[model samples]
Target: DHTHLKKALVFTNSRTDAEETILEMRRMAAKRGERDVFHVHHGSISAMLREETEAALRQGPGPAVAAATLTLELGIDLGELERVLQLGAPYSCASFVQRLGRSGRRGDAASEMIFVTPEEEDEEAQLPARMPWTLLRAIAVIELYVREKWVEPLNVRQLPVGLLYHQTMSILKSMGEAEPEDLKEAVLSLPSFRGIDPADYDAFMEYMIGMGHIETMEEGTVLIGLAGEKIVNNFRFYAVFKDDEEHVVYNGTEEIGSITTVPPPGYCFTLAGKLWKIEEVDTRHKAVYVKSSRGKVDTLWLGAGGDVHTRIMAKIREVLGSTALYPYLAPSAAARLERARRLAKESGLLTSEVLPAGGDSMFILPWAGSRQFRTLERLLKNNLKGRLGLRSIVPMEPYYMVVAGRTDAETLQEEIIA
Candidate 1:
C-alpha cells in the first residue's frame, strides 16, 4: 500500500505481463482513492508515450512507477528509483544483474530488490511440489554470481554462414567491386568473421555467384549481382539479424502498433490494451491493416530463452539433498523445502538413491546435471537396452529418472554402476 512513494521500476518477462501489472496496480490505486499512476514502457508502445514515461521516470522524486520488460535493463538511465522488483523467474544471470543494478544508483543509500515468488501447488507432479523450481532457480543464479561470477560465454562461430552472407553483400555494396582474394581478406579478417577460412570464403562466394547474390566480372573482380543489388538497395539488408521489413499495424487511420510480420485476414492479435483483427495486409508497402475486435487473444511476447548451467543444476540438487536451510527463504519457502525433503526421505530417495512409484516403475536419483544426465540417458537408451535385460531407461532432468523393467531398483543400480 505504501508502494506509492517507492518510485519503483518493476520488471517482467513479457510486455503483456508488464502492461497487465500496471493495469492491476492502477486498479488497486483506484480502490484506495489514489491516482491511477502506473505506466508501461516497451518496444511496441508509441514513441510519444515511451518518451513521456522515460521523461517522468528521469525527472525526480515524484511517484513514477513504470512496469517494463528488458527494454529498461540496458544502459538507459531512469533517475533514482527506490525499488526494483522482479515479478517472475529471470531468464539468465546476466539479466538478473542488469535488472538488479538499476536500483542503488543513488549515492550510498544502497539499492534494493524484492523478488515476489508465487506459491507452489501440492500435487505430486513429476517435480516435487515443495521444491519450487522458480525460487530455487533464483537462488542458484545468485549462487553462481557470487561463487564464480560466471556468465555464459558467447556461442562459438564455427560456420557463421549467415553473417558471412550478410557481410559479403555489405562489402560489395560499400566498395562496389573488388577481387575475390581481396574480398576474402577484407571480409574474413573482421573479428566476427575471423574464424572463417579462406577456402570456406571462396566456396561461399562461388555459391553466391551461382545463386546470383554476386556476379563475376570478365576482369575477375566480383560485384553485387542483380539479385544482390535488390537486397542491398532495400533498407532491410543492413540488419545483422533477419527480420520482416517493418510492417506498420494500423486500425483504420490510427496506428495501433507495428510488427515485423503482418497477420493474414481474420488473424487476431493483442496490441496496446485491446485485441484487434487483421483486415488487410499490403506486402508492397509492408503495412498491416486492422480493425478493433475484443474477446481473448494470445499475448505477443518476444523473449530470449536461456540455457541452464551445469553448476546451477548441481546446486539445485544440493538444495534438495542437503538438510541446510537457505537463510534467504521466507517462511513459506522454508515450508516448501521441508515438505520436499520429507517426500524424498519417505520415498527412500535420499537413503537408497532410488524410490518406487507403483507397478513396475521406479525413480532413480542421479545428482548429475543436464549434460551428464543427457549423456546417461543416451547411454541407457542406446547401450543398455539389451545388455541388462532392461525394459526401459528414462532420464528426468534436474533430479531423478523413471526406470522400469524386470530388474529391481537395487539390482539395476548395481548393474548400471558395474
Candidate 2:
C-alpha cells in the first residue's frame, strides 16, 4: 500500500471489538513490516491517548488506522479520511450510511467501504441475513439521495415521560428545591420534550406529589422527598431508562467495568470482543464482575423494539413489484429480496387489497413501514377495535397484519381508504 494512503478508520459497534480490531490490524501490519501504522480509539481508552491519535491522524501522510466505536461517528474533525472499514453490519440503515459518509474526503474518487461480516453459525446469525435486503436498502438510500436530495427528518415529537421522571429528581437533587411552574417550563423547553401537552405536564406533577415522589413546600418550591432522594442517590438512576439489575466487573482486586444487568450464571457474553465469565455479582452496586472466558452469547433486552416507517416498507414492496434490478445489490441481498417477492406473489399478497390471515381475522398489507403501522394500529385500536369486535392486532414486516375477532376486511379497508 502507498504511504500516502495511510490514514484509515475501522469502525466497530462495541468497545471491545474496537480494541481487538486495532490489535489485530497492528499484528497484520507487523507481518507486512508496517507495525506502527494503526491505532485504537474508543470510550474506554484514555482521553489523552484519544487526543494524541486524533492529532497524529490530522498530521496525515504516514499510514495510520484507528479502530473506533461510535465515538468517531460524529464530531472530532480529522479532516478527510482515505478509507473506511466497517467490521460488521450497523444496527440501523441510518447508522450504516453515516459511517459510509466518513471516508473519501479530500477529493478522492468516491468513498470506499468494506463491510466485513464475522463468521457465525447460529440461529441468531441468520437474523441479519434474513432481514430485508440491506444492499437494496443501501441502493435505495443512495437513489433517494440522488432523486430527491433529501434525508429523513429527525423525530423530535415523542413526549419524554421517562426523561421527565429522571430530570425532575435530578433538578430536585441538584438545586434542593424548584418552583413547580419553573420546573415544568424547564423540562418543556428541552427540544426532546416538545409537543408535550401542558395538561399532561400538570398531571405528571400531581402524580408525583400524590405518589410522594416529590414534596410541595409552603414556599412554592418542589423538594426532593424521601422517595426522590432514594432514587436520585443511586448511581443507576443517572441514566433515564429504569435499570432492572446491576453487574460489576472485578479484575482480581480492581474494578474495571460495571453493567446495569448481568447474564445468568454460566452464560457467556462478548464485551469489547473477548468472552467473559460472570464469576460474581454485587447487586447492591448493580454490577456483575466477570473474568475472561471462551465462547459467544447473544445480548437480549426487553422492549417493544424499533419502529419501521410505513413509507420504507412501501418502498420495499415497490422494489419487489418492479422488474428493475439494482446492479449494486450483493448476491445475498438480491436473493433475500427475490425470496420475499416470491412469498408475496405466492400468497397473492402483491395484488390483494385485503388479506385474510385465518378465520375470524384479517390482515391488510399496506406495504407501510413501522411508524405508519403504529399510527394506523393506534387509530384502529381506538376507533375500530371495540366496534369491530377486534380482539388483537399485530403487524409483521413487509406489510402483513394480524387482526383477530370478527373483523370485516371490507369495512376495515373502506375505513383505511376513506
Candidate 3:
C-alpha cells in the first residue's frame, strides 16, 4: 500500500531500464488512484530532470519511488527509506551491499529488499557446462561478508590512458596554456593519476602531438590544439568511454528513452521490456527518433559484462566434488556439470592435481580471478615461445585453452617454472 511505502528506490542495470521502470510504476500508481510519485534518475536523463527527481525524493511521504542506475548507489543520503529493490544480479558484491545499505535509515526494525530476476523462456538455449549457479554465488557472497567481510579489491595497476587524455584536456581548458613540466606535475600529483607514471605522461604528450591532439607554442607552452578542441567542445567528450550511437525514443514530443547502436529503418527491437520501431534517423546530431510497437527482437547488448570471482570459481569446484544435488538444477545444468566432470576425469585433473589441460602451447585454467589470470597470460607471453616453439594462445574462461603446437606436458611444466 502507499501508506506502507514511505520511500522506495529501485535499482536497474541500465539507463533505458531505469526510464522504462519509472514509467511503469507511475502508470500503476495512477491505476490505484494514487498520486504519480515516481522519479527516474540515470546517466542519460537530463541533469535538470534528475535534480528535480532528487528534490522530490528528499521531500518525503506519499510513496515516492525513484528508479535509478549506479548514479544513486553512492553516498547520496536519501534520509530514511522503506525498502530497496534490485532488478537483477548487481555487477559485484560491493554494489549489492551498497544498495542494501540504503534502506532502514530511520531506526526502523530492519530494512527490506526484494531482488527480482524477470525470467524469459528461451526454447533453443544451449546451456553452459555448469549452470551459472548465480544463487550459490549470491549466497556465498553473503556468507563471505558475514564471516570475513570480503570486498573485491580494486585494481589500479594499469594507468587508464583514456582518463589521462580527458584530464589533459580538462587541465588545459581550466588553467589555459601551461609549460610542459608544470603540466606534467599538475597531472601526476593528482590522487586519481597516482597509477600513471611520469614517463608514461611524457609518452602521452608525444602521442598527443603525433595525433594532432595537442601542440606546443613557440614560447614552449602546451595548449589544446585543433583536434583536442574538437573533442573537448563536444558534450560526449566529457565521458571517458565511447558512447554507443543511440536514438531518442519519444511518444509524440515527450522523450521516453534512448537505444544504443540504432538498427536500419523498419527494423524492430525490444528495449526496456518494450518493442520499438525506428521511425527516423538524425545522423547529423547522432540521434534516432523512434515510436513504440509490439513484437520482440534481440535488444540487450551481448558484450562481455564482467568477470566471475575466484571464490565463485572455487565454489563451483567444491560443488562438483560434493554429493549434494541442487533441486533447481535444470536438465541442461545437470548435463553440463556431467560433461565437465567427465572431461575433468579424462584429463586426470581431479586426482593428479596437475592442471590437466597441459601441452607445449596449452591454456591454463587456474580458476584464478581475472587480474591473476591476466597476469599469468602476460607472464606466459613474455617468458615462453622462443624457448619452446610455443606460438599463439587464447584462453576461454572457466577451463578451456587453444594451443599452437603439440609438445609434451613435462617439458611445458619445466618451461612454466623457469
Candidate 4:
C-alpha cells in the first residue's frame, strides 16, 4: 500500500510454501490494484525467469515482493531489500542470520526480519497438545544465540558410503577407466571422503562390481558397468543428493514449479497461491501443463520433516519449568506460552516421566533427542515385544514417546527400573 515498501523477500522452508506464498501475495496485491508485482524464485524455477525476478527487484519503481526458498539465502543481490520475512522459525541459527542480513542496506537504515509462526491448534482437549513447540523453539534458538552465540555446527559424516558409490562411478566414467589402486587414491584424495579407509573402499568396490555398478577390464582397471554408465551419462547425476522423481510444471510456455506427484486434469492444486488445473500431464516430457483456475488447494512437496536438536529440546523443557516471561513474545504468543506453561505443570511434562494417554496407551516423556527416542523404540519393539505385548512405540522427537498395547504404569516403571 505504501511506496516505501519497494522490495521485500519472504523466505519459506520449502519450495511448495514459496510458490504458495507467491500466489497468495499476488492475490492480495491484486486486490489493492497491484498486478504482476509478486514473483517466486526457487531452484526449480528456470534460470531466465529467476534472473528476470532479480532484474525486476533491482530496478523497481513501485513495490515488488519475492516469495522465495533457500535458493535466495546465499548472498544473492536482490536490490534495495527493505525487509525480510521468515514464514517459520528458521531451520538453524545460521539461516536465521543469513535471512536477516538481506535487508536495510540503505545508508544507516536498520535491517529487519519479522518471524511469523502459528501457535499449535487445540483439538479434543488433548493434554500437552497445546504446547507451542515451534514457538518455544524459535524463542530458545534466539535466546541461545543471544546468550551463548550457539550455532549448529556442520555435520559431516565420516563414511559417506552413498556418496562414495556415486563418486566412484563418476570418476571412472570421466577418466575413461582407472585401476583398483588408482581408484582408491583418487576417491581418498577428496577431502569429503578422506576419512574412508582403503580396506573399506576395497569392500565397497567388490560390492559395486558384484552389483554391476563397476566392471573390471583386461588390465585390472575398472570401467563403468552397464548400470553405472546409464546414471553418469545423465546431467542430473552430477549432484550428490538423491532427488525424488519430479514432474515439471508449466503454465502455457512458462514453468511455474515442479512436483514429485502428478495430479490429473481438473484435479485442483496450488502453486505460487491461486488455483491451477492440470491441463495436460506429459509423462514423456516429464512436464505438466497447467491453467489458472478458481479456488484454493493444499500443496505438498516430497521431503522429510527436520530433526530437532538436543539443545533446543533441553531449552523447551527449561521454558516449560520456568516462569520467566520473554519480552519478545506477541500478545497471542505470550498468552499461548502461559497456557502451555500451565498445561506442562498440570500434565507432569516437567515433573513426571510417565503420563497416561486416553486409550490403554501410556505416554513416556523422556525428553531425549531423536537417536535415544529411536533406540528406545527398537528396544521396546524387539526386546519387550512378547513380554510386554508392546503394540507400538512411537517416537515423537524432542517431546515424548507413546507406548501402547496392554501396558500399564507399573510395567513401564518396572521395565525402566530393571
Best by lDDT: 4
- Give me the overall lDDT of model 1: 0.74
lDDT of each: 0.74, 0.65, 0.65, 0.77
TM-score of each model, in listed order: 0.70, 0.63, 0.62, 0.82
lDDT of 2 at 196: 81
Residues 1-418 of candidate 4: C-alpha lDDT, one tens digit per residue: 3222567778888877787777766777777785677777877777767887787777866477787887888767877776677887775677776777787778888877777887656756456556777788788777777677887777788998878888887788877878789878888899988888788889998998998979998888889899887888887888777767888888899877677888787787876545788989899999999898877676756654456666767777898889998887788988888888988888777887778786878778766665666776777778886788878887666577777878787678578657
Query: What's the alpha carbon RMSD for model 2?
Result: 6.6
Q: The CA-based lDDT of model 2 is what?
A: 0.65
Q: Report the number of the highest-TM-score candidate.
A: 4
Weakest 10 consecutive residues of candidate 2 by summed lDDT: 120-129
In order of listing, the candidates' clash counts read: 1, 18, 1, 3
Cα lDDT tens digits, model 2, 1-418, are 3222467788877765675665555556657775566666765444556777687677857567787877888778877677777765454456656787787677755866766554332434222223354443444545554455645667764776778888777866777788888888887887766788879989999999888889999987888887777878889889666555535556566544444446666666644433567776666766666787754554332234334454455555676677677655567656656765666566666676566666787766666666676777787789878987889987664346677877677877887777
Flag the better candidate by lDDT, 1 or 3: 1
lDDT of 3 by residue, 2-113 (tens): 2235677888777656756765665567678877677877765555567766776677564677888888987676767776777765656677778878776777556556
TM-score of 4: 0.82
Off by over 4 Å in 3: 1-88, 102-108, 111-128, 131-133, 154-180, 193-241, 307-363, 375-405, 408-418
Worst 10 residues of 4 by lDDT: 1-10
